[model samples]
Target chain A: MHRIERYYDSIFTKQSPEQLARDIMKKADSSAKKRSFRPLAVVAAAAVVLVGGVTAAAATGLLNINELFGGRISTQDEQFAGELVGAAQDFQWTTSDDDYVINLKGVTGSERDMLLLYEIARADGRPVTEYMTNIPEDGELDCAENLGFDLNAGAFKAGNYRYHYSINDDGNIDVYNLAVTDGDISGQQFYAEVINLYPKQLLSDFEAKHDIFDWAGGADTPAGFYRWGDNEAFDAGQPCDVALNDERIIGLELEWTIEFTYSPSDTAKLSKVITDEKSVVSLNYEKSYGGVWTYPLLRITDSYFSSVSGRIDLVREGYMRGQTFDTCNDIYLLLENGDKISCTAFTGVSSYDRHEKMSSFSVEIQYSEELNGPITAVDISKVEAISINGEVFSLI
Target chain B: MQGDEFTQYVRKYSDMVYRVAYSCTHSAPDSEDIMQDVLLKLYICEKKFHDDEHVKAWLIRVAVNRSRDVLRSVNKKRTEELQEGLSVSDEEPSSDLHTAMAGLSRDHRLVIYLFYYEGYSVKEISKILRITESNVKTRLKRAREKLRAFLNDE
Candidate 1:
């Protein structure tokens, strides 16, 4: 192994935990000062300030300003609805006393936008709590949180927009109070859900039906975990979270691979005599998976392919021109003993479903013995910088 | 809950929080900024920690989300980092492992850091990330494989 001790030392020297922590605390203190001056008389009744000092109160892992600005605190008692904005313009919402009616339209393709709605209500007229979108199993079931409001974590597929709505316990439905912001919006919504886990029950049932599971109970000391869900799981048309172990967490795509094969041909090499017995062969391999992915958003990049000319290129070219000229598939070059050998490569194919719902995914192609040989090694070039839903998360 | 407990917790988990911030933003200053933000946030959240799990999850999520925000502030920031020959010290690898990690995607780097550096299980990571457990495992495997490929390359 090539040890880069100097490199590691330099990197560590650049950062110190104590200094970083102190800096964070100082920023929070400043933000807290700004928050303190904001008059809370209007919403004070609806909300409560649990902590007073930013620096003095060290027990709460929450910064002083967090309570002031962490979540979208809706303290309004009156019901008001705003126009659906951004990518959710396609959905139509109507409010009823018991439920908020939502019908989506104008979806031309399979892609959709993320929707996060809070069902706000007062308990005995004192704001008991705002239950996160914890909808019951049946679509019509009433969410028994404060105000009978059904909080929804919505991801609408088959569209270019997002939608939001709310129903107060007084039977007044408001669907337009939804706010939209770009960049990791879905993550923020998920963060809200994490803060309130009561809605896990509602999501748990949804995932139970629409979610796909890996092999369960595989070992006494398990190396992994598993879950299952069905259709409504992907209904939002965007990626949403699901409770895997009776805990509500966002579903994600688990990747698996299978071998694919293709036959080789000598159609391109006209110089080679058409021998009756010595037939040229071409082989192709495809790699893919079988499972529903958890992420609500999925994207694919331009595929790249390369092969050795002298060793494997001859075989690959013969097969390509003669049988199937699919340059889209990976074919590579191999060099050995001054002979050019042909090889193939296809990697880094990723699936980003907004909601981790797909059950199975794989690749298929033709196969041949002429393409098989004792491999001395392998070579692959990686490409990074692919974006996932505005967050440059990773394609690997 | 006492001064001693608070101090102990801070000392023990400060590195974890810093690493989380570093992985998310891939910048030393930003990571430091995130750590500071998280500590203060924790200080005020007053939502009592049920156990270490709850606190860990809260810190990691806040650091990650804050770092994500930092990424958004300057579009030119990431663009400049990716451009050739900037030699930004933050981007330098601490070890061959770190270099390989720097070369990875943000998600890959995050998963690797949390799993290997912080020593969290896929389940714990899933909770901390609000992602599925299997997703964490798959990412870990792919990250390891990629790291192998990177390290083995001459």
Candidate 2:
């Protein structure tokens, strides 16, 4: 095989056809039923709405911030808000550039997660009428108005945005929920800038030409990672750990370093190694899944294995394309005396990298009877199948 | 397609759709979700396919579009790495290639997977991805150069 072809083969594992058939059929049946039911449901809903005086509310002059938020806060924000004892709620900070004046209304939530409430206004003191006009009559902001947080650290993340027009007839006031999961942001003060302010016309035009929410190769914005200096407004503040309901913003210029403390430890070490022309098999044992149990790990380099075994252990299950299968049930340990002992409590840990055509697995097994003699090779002919290039080979 | 033909269609093209989705999303759950959505779309689509190639092309297009939708959603921030659940492979190239692919941008990886692994010509890929043929060729070339640089650096 060519070098690149082999690498590609190793990475893309063909899925099991039978399992996929079953899943597809199930979904198809459900969708067919839903398709049939939709028309009747629409008729029923129309009759009810006509009798109940349920008219859609019309848009008002100034957008209500509380109404826009809908009182929905993420779990992280709730937890952060619960942790702070005395979070400030009355500080205000403002900064302005040539194009816009940015105001920091308040900071709330905990060290783990924070909510920054701020307003952006045109420097010419014009009501952000242009931006508000583009908002749908239902007060829904299109995908273009969704300003994602970009970090300079190159880590990808996601956040929630909620906003409405300022009550005082100013510009837009929005709440940005900034969350840090794999790092610490406790008691840290940093500068935040509003980077890209899209004009109403361009946003409306872009939203019209494409599916605004459809991400497929069209929306190229990095979801959670922040790019430094992308937003150029120089506004610095110390976010307090308080309830998300707190609206007090604190103004400060503080330098803080974001430190990451999340790390992954290697849980397994090579116990036995096998070298062959086409493959390398390594036996390993590691503590995983909360360190309560130790799993036998195997690294099989080369062709995928339907089943693999060492002198002492046997793998009874296999995994491919993120699906697990009990490929083998009954396993026996062949001793030097030509007798066999049944194995029980078999657990397999199968890992495969399709790009390199390598599979690693560790099986934890318990024998029914204690052995008194030396053992030979493990019998794996009972495995259901092994697949390579969409071809399945039965071990039996 | 209906019933038996639809079953055959899924059996024939599900893997291709899945690979394309995985190449873009890199998350197993996300890929599976995309695969399911694409297959469901195919099952319900009234469009008739002239041949296996046409069906395959349509599936790839849907998979790519659905995968992009998942990536662009507000919840696309993935806290866990793809390899976190499984043990690291022993083969150097296997792990190295995974890291290298991860280093490349999603756009670069998608073109490379389509051109090399899926065996699609530049023209076919351009149609499947809704881009110009020159764009596809350029992405493929740039992807190869980036892959070479990554491998050499490693």
Candidate 3:
């Protein structure tokens, strides 16, 4: 037998077809699980913070930041994250309320933004997938339709986007939160807390009730994490530390509050920050949704392109329901030697229900071997036109 | 179908369905999920087949389509580990060829697996994968070249 075939044969032989068949039959035979609604606050909360330094990579196999930051950041962009590895001073404490454990993996930043990396897992070690059954792809589920947090770093406010996660081999769900802010928060002692996990409908209500977005620096009205829709008075849209009553959130239950300090001076020392608003270009496409065509404008508001990865901020008009493409999808970089490079992977972030009005997203693009093309770590200096779904926007 | 018939059908082609799914996804968990889903569809599906080979081809097509759906739903690569729950032999062969095979792209890997391992011809593979016969041969040629390059580098 050929060596390649033999190698796979060994691996494939270990699988038990009978066992898999039995598992399948079991799920088929079993009835759908009964849905439960247990309002929060009265769930017998047991929350604690186990402060384990960023030696998580030393303890765990890998940080898995690439997995979380996939398609959004470039390989060159990863160098910035790598610089902060094992350099976290006072980071990564675990927060366990009742059912799940949230471990703050590390805190990373540039002069413009900061990222609080953390993972969530069941306290009892059951696969979180069993409960968060709606999404089984890569063990990912946005348990809360909308997530909000408060990182008490001066002049830096973090708004929670859709929770992007995947279960690791150890059965932990790593969640990524990148908060953009102004000014340098160097040597900042941040009491970073992932304060709320709820839906967007609750978000508008919380904002209406509170009327203000974040607690002004040192205000002491709502202390910490709270259950949304519980006290109606509890800040569902912002960070607070008290759970009243009412069970709105269903899975990965509870708000995570962990205290960690960050100093990005070391990591940011060599980090390159590039911006090009000098070149302005927009592409117009007759976007078809549900057999109806609407002309949507794709405008590049701002951009930062590295040789290997970059982020593009886009403002799009002409909204449609269930738009299935990212701003950076199918982009290619025309190289110096007349070669083309593919924008291999991307993680585009945008509001779920941005209809009619303008919607904007700054998507990160990187290359993975997933594409069947002339893929390379993008050399940004080449003679260039940015290709978006076939229309070329010249960068020369 | 009776309970035993369901079990019998699934067990007979469980590995093949899983292998097809795994080639597209490169994710064991997603592959396992796809396997169960495809088998369940078969159990409930009203279509009749000429024979076991016909049933096998249909299952392969479903597995491929389902894997494509999973990929298109999200443009993200997943964890590359072999599923931790699977029971394996202590004497399983360990080689650089295993590593090189994994390094190939999904299309390349799928075509290579079918052509050389499963003994599917270029024509049969094109039909199974819903691609042109030329596309199958191209992928096979590219996969072989890539594997050779990878091994040579070592």
Candidate 4:
């Protein structure tokens, strides 16, 4: 044995093989026997106790909200949120009464989280250069809570708009990127009501000094909300802006509709299952045309809809070398009983095929559930590949 | 597998499974737990194996996957248990080579252990780990460089 192997072997040699095997066999034997009703009753009683304990803890405030929410609350700025900037859909809308020019620059994000980039400016070719000089220099503006402005009170009222922003270096608020961490917006049109606008300098200074903006408090300022009466008139790609106060500034009342499509390469639907001496291999082809790339999936299932072990060939060579590769293709299995189960591939070895002049790869697909029957066929008929050149290839 | 056949297979490959699991986990009890799970999977798997080499490959793949799952599980109690159950001693490694191997990252250490210690080829390790052959080669090269740097410093 090699020296390192010997050292590893010695470290783990404390567990006797015979005893370990005996213990495993015992576990297997006990699991094989029919489960008794008494154990089920005990488990039900235990579950009842657990629920009661959780409810009591919640009522007593002993359960931390951060812990309850899976501990996702972070004091750091959201990274990778800016990557969506490049892929945002463009829109330009101006208010009817005020003529404030609001350009919805782009929209980029996943199904659950989205980022909206927009610019608010003047309509008569002048800079919106006024800063809120009333508040204390040390004070910070809470953007989300200041969505609704109270005109009589001369300040922003409290509201729930879970969004954040970053100022550009030019000190002009060129892009107001609103990070939305809620429901799917793909293929849907939505309107952003421009209730108020704070000076770019004030927002930037507050952000710079504080470094962390609380999404839960109102900004105490003299900047009142502009009640644009024609919120219904705005639509995506329409040129419109709103006039707040006596200023001829155009602020974007943003409206946009997004459509996400996938078109893989020409050979997306081509798939085959080949069984060799060692194991079975499934070959699948997938590609994504544009937008946020979802992983190209390949699933293996038995006749009974139970998943099997398999892998796909989709590893790009430059991924490990700091190269960004798009993985937006969908593959699934259609069982005999008319049920569909999503398939995923394990990370596999990737190499370049000199003869084929392309990166060659294969992944191992692992399914834990045992199958009731043998797999009948390899299904690539459901694969969708959207090509970068605007071609949709789907297997019928 | 059943009765004598299963027992014989366990006896033949138990050390191999244990070592591979330990290399990934760095915890003895967790490695043992992974070994038991891998062996149980082999017992229940209905797929036919062509030979001993095939069986070994399958066991390594299953063990590696199970070890990763254990590491990724959300239960904090398990992590506490692992800390209490495993600890390295100065006497564990007799030579600088063994000590250098322990200092590598889990990914680098695993590839090295499989390549140099367990005598697996880069191609075989790729399939077993579900990575590309080029990735395996890169990892191996990096692991050797790390080892050389450590030994030279010593």
Task: Score candidate 4 by lDDT.
Answer: 0.42
Q: Per-prediction fnat values? A: 0.16, 0.20, 0.24, 0.24
For candidate 1, write residues A1-396 as lDDT tens digits: 223333323343244555544555566668778877876752563233211211110000111111212233221212111211222323433233223322332212211232433332332332212222222211222222211111122221111222233334433323222223333322121111111112232232223333333222111111122222222334333333232222122232111111111111332111112111110000111100111112332233332322221111111100011112122233222223223223322222223233422211122222212354654433323323222212232324
The true-structure Cα RMSD of candidate 2 reads 26.5
- Evaluating just chain A, the predictions reach TM-scores of 0.19, 0.22, 0.27, 0.23
Model 3 Cα RMSD, 1 decimal: 21.8
Best by lDDT: 3
Model 2: TM-score, first chain = 0.22
- Please write out the lDDT profile of model 4 over residues B1-154, one tens digit for every residue: 7757677778888878877777777776777788888887776566578998888888887777666566656562347344533444345564676667666655677888788777899889976664545457656656777888988899
Computed on alpha carbons, the lDDT of every model, listed in order, comes to: 0.36, 0.41, 0.47, 0.42
TM-score of the second chain for every model: 0.82, 0.88, 0.84, 0.85
Ranking by TM-score: 1, 2, 4, 3
Give DockQ for candidates 1 onward, in order. Answer: 0.23, 0.10, 0.14, 0.12
Candidate 4's C-alpha runs over 4 A off are A34-396, B75-91, B95-99
**Weakest lDDT window of 10 consecutive positions for candidate 2 chain A:** A279-288
Candidate achieving higher TM-score, 3 or 4: 4
Query: Model 3, residue A96: what's the lDDT?
Result: 22
* lDDT per residue as tens, model 3, A141-200: 143212234232221222222224444655455656564533332321122334333222
Could you give the candidate ranking by DockQ, starting with the highest? 1, 3, 4, 2
Question: What is model 1's DockQ versus the real complex?
Answer: 0.23
Quick one: how many clashes does candidate 2 have?
Answer: 19
Among all windows of ten consecutive residues in candidate 1 chain A, which has the lowest summed lDDT?
A: A53-62
DockQ of 4: 0.12
